[model samples]
Target: MHLAHYLGLLHRSQANLASAFREVAAAHADEPDIEHLCLRQAAICDTHAERLHPFAERYAEEAPREPDRLHSTLFSGTRTGGIALLRDLQDLYLMASECDICWTVIGQAAYGARDRDLLATVRDGEGETAAQLTWLRSRMKQAAPQALVVAD
Candidate 1:
C-alpha cells in the first residue's frame, strides 16, 4: 500500500545519483578511469529508475501524500585537485549508500507484496549499487595517500 511512496522516493534518488555521477565525471574528466566509470554508473542509475516507473504508477493510487523532506540533495558541485577528487568520491559513496539501503527496503516490500518483477529489479539494482560503493571506496583509498601525505 505504502510501497508507492518508496517507489517514488527511489525513482527520484536514482535520478539524483545519476546526475551527481555525471557532474563528478565531468569535473574529473582528467581522470580517465573515473570519467568512464562514473558515466557507466550513471547509466546504471538511469536503468534503475526506468525499471521502477511502472511499479510507481501501479501503486500511485494507494500512496498517501508524500511527506516533506522525503528527498535531500547529496551532491552540490564537484571540487578540483587530488584531495577534492577524494572528497567528491566520498560524497558519491554516501549517495550510493542511500540507494543501496533503499534497494534493500524496497526488496523487502516487493517480497511482502509478492511482486516478482519489482524484486528482480531490486536485486539487479542492488548489485550495481554495491559495485558503485565499492569502486568509490577503493578509488578514495587510492587517492588518499597521494592527496593527504604527499606534498602538493
Candidate 2:
C-alpha cells in the first residue's frame, strides 16, 4: 500500500529534521533560545519516528518498503553571529512549512485508507507543527534586529 511509502518518507524527513535541529543547537552557540527550541524539536521528531514504526509495518503489505534515503539539508561553512543562527532558524521554518504539506498529504491518505490511527496522529501533529511554526516565526522576529546590525 502507499501508506508504506508515505510513512517511510515521513519517517526519513522527521529523522533529518531532528538531526538538523541537534546540529543547529550545537553549532549556534550564541542563540540559547534557538538552541533550546532545536533540541525540543529534535525530541519531537524522535517521538514521531517511534510513532511511525508500527504504521510502516502495518501497511507495508508486500510493497518492499521503498528504501528510505537521508535528505540532507546541510549548511556549509563556519557558523558565526546571530545572523548565522537566524538563517538556520529560517531554514528550519522552510523545512517545517514543507512538512506541513507532507502532513496534509498524510491526512488525505488517511481518509482514503480509513485508518483512524493515522488520521488522529496526523491531525494532532499538524496542530503541534502549527504551534512550532508560530514559535519559529516569533523567534525570527525577535532575532532580526540583532541579526541585521553590522559592526561599526
What's each prediction's clash count? 0, 0
lDDT of 1 by residue, 54-124 (tens): 88888882332221122234354457665888888887887788789879999999899999998999999
TM-score, every prediction: 0.89, 0.84
By TM-score, the best candidate is 1
After superposing candidate 1 on the true structure, give the runs of residues whose Cα lies further than 4 Å from its correct spot.
61-73
User: Residue 41 of candidate 1: its Cα lDDT?
Assistant: 91
lDDT of candidate model 1 versus the reference = 0.81
**What TM-score number comes out for model 2?**
0.84
Models, CA RMSD each: 2.9, 3.2
lDDT of 2 by residue, 1-152 (tens): 57666677776677677777787888875655767878998898788767777777887722222222323434454467658877887877876776677788988999998999989889877887787789889988888888898542
